[model samples]
Target: SQQGEEDPQALSIQEGENATMNCSYKTSINNLQWYRQNSGRGLVHLILIRSNEREKHSGRLRVTLDTSKKSSSLLITASRAADTASYFCATDLLQGAQKLVFGQGTRLTINP
Candidate 1:
């Protein structure tokens, strides 16, 4: 299983500041994906970086992958109060086929 673990179980930041988090995975994977969850709601995919790729960006979100270390980092620039949510990193494992394994997640709070 290509499961990942996230660091800094929790974080607190004010609006306009950037929030960064890291994710580490075990075993080789096909791709890595980042997601955001608002409270108890469902998760929304923020970005995806393939194993062959090093980095990717979407709006204020930036993601970097280091396959040599089996880890990845996510940075949210100029965060807002609405960005307060739980962020998760998932890895796509291809064992003959494909499946996604999610990490524990990082809980972030953006204070006004």
Candidate 2:
């Protein structure tokens, strides 16, 4: 599968803590995007980093990409219970245009 692999698969943390997830892809990519999905809901775009970028941030979210390692990570600081959801990393391959391959996802549970 072109889909990447996310580490930990699942994580549980208390509110106000930080949560981190890692994703490793098999091929070179044009860009990487992080998404969040609550139960029974559609995916919400969190952040995106281009191949040329090493890191990007959005509010409480921070994303870092390492093209040489074909990997990326997502960090959510001061997580809240509302942050409980599934996070997925999607990659836009350099060769495959107009297509995104998504990881299996990392399930995050933030307890109050």
Number of the top-ranking candidate, with lDDT as the measure: 2
- Candidate 2 residue lDDT tens string, 12-78: 9999999999999998899999999999999999999999999999999999999999999999999
Question: How accurate locally, in lDDT, is each candidate?
Answer: 0.92, 0.94
All candidates: TM-score: 0.94, 0.97
Q: How close is candidate 1 to the true structure, as a TM-score?
A: 0.94
Give the Cα-based TM-score of candidate 2 against the true structure: 0.97
Top candidate (TM-score): 2
lDDT (10s digit) by residue, model 1, range 20-71 = 9999998788899999999879999999999999999999999999999999
The positional error of residue 92 in candidate 2, measured at the CA in angstroms, is 0.3
